[model samples]
Target: MDRTAHGLTSLRNGVKTLPLAPMRDNSEIRTLIDRVLPVVDEWREHLTVSIGRATELTGLKDTQIRYFEELYRQDRDPAASSGVTRSYSLTDLRRLAVFAELLKEGYRPAQAAEIVRSFADAIDYGAAYTVADALRREGDAITDGFLLSRLASQVIFAAQREIGERLPDARIIAMFLVERRIDGVSAEEFVDIARDIATHPQNVLVAVDRAAVIGNESDSSESVWSDDESSIVLFYSRDPWSVPVPDRAQFCYYRPPSTPDATVVFMVESAGYRSIPPELTVKTSARDHLLDWMVRMCLSIFPEFRQATRAHNYRYRSDGYRLAHTRQSLTRLMHRVRDLIFGDDADVSVACLLLPDDLYKPMYLSILAHAGYPEARARQARLMLYGEGEGLSGRAFNAREPFLTLDAEQDLRVFGAQDERCKVALAAPLLSHWDTHPFGVLYLASQRPASPLWSETAFVALVFGNILSELLGRWWLTRLRRKHDNLLHRYVAEYIRWFNGMDMHGPEFNEGLQQIERIWERIAVTSASSGNVRTVVERLSRQYVTLVVLDIDRSRQLHSRGDEPFLLAAQRHVHQAIAQILPDVRGYWFKNDHTLLVLDGYAPEEAIVLIRRIAGRVQMVPVVIEGRTERTTVTISAALKSLSYQELYDLSHHDREVLRSSLMTIIDTIYEQTRGCERTIKVFQHGVWEKV
Candidate 1:
């Protein structure tokens, strides 16, 4: 169904392109699927078509085709000057089909032939077949026209629903029926003409002249309606299909999604987003072929339309379906990769992704998903397969590249500890554009090492890994967007109600503004344009704080001893240590070297003992740094301060400032004092320091 979505990547966005809006059932209209499919399949076939073949192509006899071709010099077949039994080419066939469509629309042979000649270049064979398909599907319904009331409601509702009335100005709409431009007609006139010409089914397109209305064009090589003569133009066969250069990256043609083979497209120019009574916009239906054509037109010719749809992709639809859609998409790709890499032995092979626990401090990957492994083995692997620098998965993850081992048991990278049945293995790091380095590892192991070519490995590493990362990243972004939206509604909605035409400069109003800003600051994941979450509210109240900061001492020294990964592992080790030492205290990660623990109602004496205990525990953690296991020391800097309402405005920054001035050097000295000279660190009432 050509669900590529003009490259929107529906895989991540989760809006399944709906079925091609079908035409209403019509018994009298002969079915043309067989004929249409053949013409569509041979759309580009350059071979000459015989007079007999041409008759079949257009459902017209030789006499009518000859009369039309001879009468219209513009759509006449190329000059061959062949014998008496004259032949026709594919172009001749398209012209004849178009002419036949026109004739069926109650146009006399002369008028129909004239159109085929005048707009010879404007008509496409794709349009002819599309018109045929529409005719056999819609019957005489379109000729019936729509009531002004229903049409008005559909237009108004769909526009505000899809675009939320964001576009400026009232857009004017026009329709091109065959070669006639039905421009700027009244509501009654529009409906009357629509039904008057509805005798034959036509392939329609809603063309929007973006340049006429839209401002601030985006940086995209999208196709513009070079032939735009109105604000919003509709084209059809019995119709005119706009010329689109599909081979070029920039072109206006948009093929029907229902019939992918129909290359002819009608374009809609979203002319600065106009207004009319509005055109009915229910593009969803088996019988909604006309409105569906409108949708395809805009998406194809206008980048702004595509942008609008992409921007609103998940609002309500994504929140409900994105997770399952993303998971299914990812899983299908994994299974395909497995089949590509393993073939007949795929059932006995294993391919799994290992998402690491933490990026730094303790670097290790766990099996996030797997195939071929029994449930028990998959669980076991999930728990302990890739530990520290233990397996091929770890090797790939740590190296941030692809790793391959022809023999797993004999390879030292496998660590001789797991996946006993696997004889060969391969792993590649999955890279994320959002992250600084690899986000996860794609691991593959087999019961027997099948000889796979380098191309296969490269395919898995490059294509599979990239697609996985894209889907995962998009899914994550969707989730984050949903969270951010919810936060805005929940935290800012109440504050907005107090903002009527109240005093412009009153203290109460200013205070209300401050309160709203503070609420946003505290709750927003994305703040003002910055995407840093400083304080996450676990409990909300006018609670007091005992802010304690812990730092990994001389963290750079670990980098000199081991790779950067080892340095990260060292940080993780320290974080885990601090977490265990003060299990009851809530600590926030503040970079590789520090953890900020905020305690409520803890006395100065309690803060002193807690920091010392954290420092001691962190110093004793056996951190794996640069391939070596060693104990690393940490520096404890602290504060025992209470916050008034105003002080909590920039909570994290305020806490850090207090920690910076808390005499960290003296605190360190006390934690490291010799046995007999041990001293205590304390904060007195009213937030003062005391050394005891």
Candidate 2:
């Protein structure tokens, strides 16, 4: 009876705040009917809800409403209006929203009313035509789209059978005795309780079965029906209830689902007891009321307990489901809010805005595909974000990334965008906290135009869209970092391969260098250009790498920094870090103090990480030195041709630096990258690269 018990004041206030419509004439109705019918026809099946809601919320007067009523009239008795109240369901609210849409679009009350009437007529025709067409094709069998028809029919029949069996018992014995003129007031009251229990007779049967099972039908054995020894004696009796005296002895219960497997007992005595009155009396009636209360308590509390148990199980076995459930819950709440205010016909879409134009092209062309956005459309949207003049079409205006209806009339002016065909749009601002210029934007769009139902669906989607955009941005950031790290690895591997010819401890060094080289090659091939995959590799290699083996004053101390896997991988870090750190040393193009370059061709501006790491480790303070050396590889090639390690090791420290720098330069040179004006660089002294 009270379908709208909550939010009455809020709904009333919202309606009061809305602008009123102007007067309407015949011409306005004709124009609206024509414009609306086409869109409605195009979306006959999917757009039914929008069409219906638009008709309802349009604020038509009684006379205007009568115009529509003539088309779908049913035989009604004059007496039907007596003491009846008209209550609108959610469906009715949707119809009202649709009417509001028509009115808000400049159609006057009368005109909008007439247009809705015509629209309803068209809808009726479309449904009838489709149904007839379908019937004409199929033979004898009907092809209705009701999925659960048979199951529902069977359930209804079974319910009717059970109700049929119980009705006679109540009518003959219970009703006759209670309704008898000689029966006292107490007897009449007992009949009322029986009627309430009979309202849902199946539930009564279940309560009876549960109470009997818990009592074990007079069995006192602790084992009862259980095979396991993990049993405990527990009381399962009717909780307190407002039952009269005669039936007070009929309370019963069994083991509740919330507690562990156990035997039932009396609540007051805390011992095994099942009270079943010998004859139908007032004591039995009172006890039955108490028993029903217990049943209700068990039913209500068991779900919460079961949910908690399942949640605990999911935490250990399926963490993904647990996280997904949280997301879904949030989404569901958003949808409910949307449904309450926006009407059920509203739809949602997303728009993404980006700062600085350069990142757009690469991001749209590359990253959009990964996120399941159409690449061509992404590129077009990218162009819109970068291009000047009234921005992309279908982009939202109020909030940069707010969910908005794309009814075209509402959104076109807001976004300041053009050349896009989206009806609804939502935009997410891709503002980077660290970068002065944002990376780029991620947006979502829907082709379907807005209707009232869109309120709930769009609200859910908006929340989901914002979440998705954040995730995408984070993913992009992580991806960019990984790409840079991988590039650093490539430069290190190449440097190692080049240095292998200079000094070979045994076959192990050769194999290790070969393996490293292969890995670097793969990284180079797989890495994306946006991540600075190539440039990072070359810069670190050039700055930090000098000789294959440095003349260290204290190798023992450096090695004793604990056996953390990260520290142990310093050998590899020494190789990769040099490739990352070198570019910032002003005019230190050819060499630095820790990284020496003799007569060997080294990579340019790379090899910074390794040099910084080893140099930082040795100097323990800043060591500022710059020098250049001749190409070492030219000489090493000749020594390697003769298979002589002694001749290779004879190479100077400057020569090793040149080789390291040259290897680092190889990766950076493959791609040209301009560093951002506000770039931040970090260097780790004790092999930070290895842990990653």
Which candidate gets the maximum lDDT versus the true structure? Answer: 1
Clashes of 2: 103
What is the overall TM-score of model 1 with all chains considered together? Answer: 0.32
Over 597-676, each residue of candidate 2 has an lDDT whose tens digit, in order, gives 22122221233433335445433322221111111110000000010122222232234455334444432221111111
lDDT of each: 0.45, 0.31
Cα lDDT of model 1 by residue, 357-393, tens digit = 5333435555545566565655445323343456776
Listed per model in order, the count of residue pairs whose N, CA or C atoms clash below 3 Å is 24, 103
Off by over 4 Å in 1: 1-117, 120-321, 356-369, 383-390, 411-420, 433-437, 453-464, 494-692
Positional deviation of residue 532's Cα in model 1 after best superposition, in angstroms: 60
lDDT of model 2 at residue 450? 47
- Judged by lDDT against the true structure, how good is candidate 2? 0.31
Report per-prediction Cα RMSD to one decimal: 23.5, 33.5
